[model samples]
Target: MALEDVSLHIEPEDIYGIIGMSGAGKSTLIRCINLLEKPVAGEILIDGNCIFRKFGKFFENNNEPELMLQGAELRNLRRQIGMIFQSHNLLMQKTVSQNIAFPMEIAGAPKHEIDKRVSELLEVVNLADKVANYPSQLSGGQRQRVSIARAMANMPKILLCDEPTSALDSLTTNQILDLLWDLNQDYKVTIVMITHEIELVKRICNKVAVIDRTRVVDQGEIGQVLLNPSMEITKQLLSGSRGTRG
Candidate 1:
């Protein structure tokens, strides 16, 4: 999906929500922030540093993209931005501890440091007992918790979550949301969550953006957008979200 003129300004330590129905381009917008998907004409700036800029409409055109960071530099920058997906995406063959240590190993961190950080993250996610367990042995929620621990292995300043709890039950979803809230408050990691569940946004997010048909129809503080939705699409979404937890 092509996102048109989609712009968002997320403040530090904010649990920002990007809400929309299926096929609304919400995933694309979030992926663009990490440059997993690049835009053709606009520039992406992280902490006021230009990541990518292009003037042309078509990315396949002859024009050169202004890549401020490429190769090793871009990889280093990605270290500061961690991504979580709907699927656990854990290595089926690796134990929880090994999975959590994967990112640090790729970055060439010292063995002792990786072990120490993995232990700390396991404790943070309240999965110290599951450190030796494989993804198949854990339940749905536990696997998600392990994934969360792995995403935090690098201590990223920003965490991009794409439907992190969409696969969990209601109780488990709330538990995950609470864990995320705690992480934001304790570690000050900015969270940008992509969800179709409006109630989930109200439960955890302070600010939100509503995407409809590949555009941001409404955005602001959670209270403002819910109380005074200016667009019809926003109102429809709100109405549809009632009684739906996931």
Candidate 2:
């Protein structure tokens, strides 16, 4: 969690990948964007506004001043930027449709809109038939698809994935990756993914960033970085040379 001087701009509608071995700070980097782990020193701008500049100071003062947003600003930002993790993270008791509808329900979307959106999203993720199934009844890939549908329920502008395919078998991994590619094409949603699998980045990411020891060692177009890695750490990662797996 010691990210140092890491800075990058993700363009609109771009699929950016962060690649590194374990303990390489990839997860920390993404978490920093949402201030999940505040950087000791750095600016985090979202949509050109510096959200983290005074975060620490604001929390420290604790004036409890009546302010705008009612803490919903941060929640709204998170809603617009969806996240998927290595674990499917579905609620055990919720049905597939219920899981996909969870976010919209939290946001208080009207019932009609929620129903329409959930149906369309289930079809998009090819999980329409599993709407009534519980998490325990679905395969790993199906579970992940349910998670994806849930993440997209709010129509996020950006999607963050953390080692999304690490647990799946090779064939399921490929199918999931292809599904992600299709999602990107159809929705034009900006994606930022963290994974140790370089091949996944090659297949889906347009831009890549290599991190090591809490620092970004390399960043560029995937083709350029893969073909001619500039940093030693980047070379090691791209060459399939494992550092500690983080």
Candidate 3:
């Protein structure tokens, strides 16, 4: 899942989409941003501060040269970057409220604070009435909503979603997309979404990158990339995405 010379510029609060066929490194790219999967080389900066930087085999945290974040430092940094997976990844045995409160609990927030935050997040995801339900008691879309609330529990500045709606039906997909869009608009959370559905990108993303063979072959403003594509893979993806939606 290593990438080469893959560079993309994503602006603040942008719903940036990364589109590629299966095995094209889209998911890996998303994971790399959050350091779930570390890059072999390159720098990842957040708010213009270099959090991760590598040169050849050496890894360094830019704030302190020749140092790498470990233990609580790494965990604290990851808190500001939330991740949503294709699988909802909810705890099947935990109630929706408990699941959403997990991150806050881990962060050592008081029980009252966790409860308050969980209630607010549930309302944001429109699942307030399902607070006591377990993952097993919810539908696919509902489960995804729980995951979204959990990801937002710590009020992350950035959200990395890996095909968050791919498992749902068309109508459900649209619902999830709308929820994500609202989150971006309301909270101004930067979002990086990986999807094969170009239509999804068209509906929400302001910028896009097309990856091919572990390399970014096309990227830019969504409209510009779609209307004036420069690569065959981008063209093919645009065509196939249209055919699927049509």
Candidate 3 colliding pairs: none
Off by over 4 Å in 1: 57-65, 242-246
Model 2: runs farther than 4 Å from truth? 54-70, 241-246
The Cα error of candidate 2 at residue 129, in Å, is 0.8
lDDT of 2 by residue, 130-232 (tens): 9899999999999998998998999998888888988899898898888788888899888899998888888889999988787888888888988888888
Clashes of 2: 4
Clashes by residue pair, model 2:
21-246, 22-245, 22-246, 23-246
What tens digits encode model 1's per-residue C-alpha lDDT throughout 22-50? 88898999988888887767778888888
The models' CA-based lDDT, in order, is 0.89, 0.83, 0.89
Off by over 4 Å in 3: 57-67, 242-246
Cα distance off (Å), candidate 1, residue 183: 0.5
lDDT of 3 by residue, 1-246 (tens): 778887787889999999988778899899887778887777778888776776654434334453355678789988888789999999988999999999889889999999999999999999999999889999999999999989999999999999999899999999999999999999999999999888899999999999989899999999999999999988888888746434
Score candidate 3 by TM-score against the native. 0.93
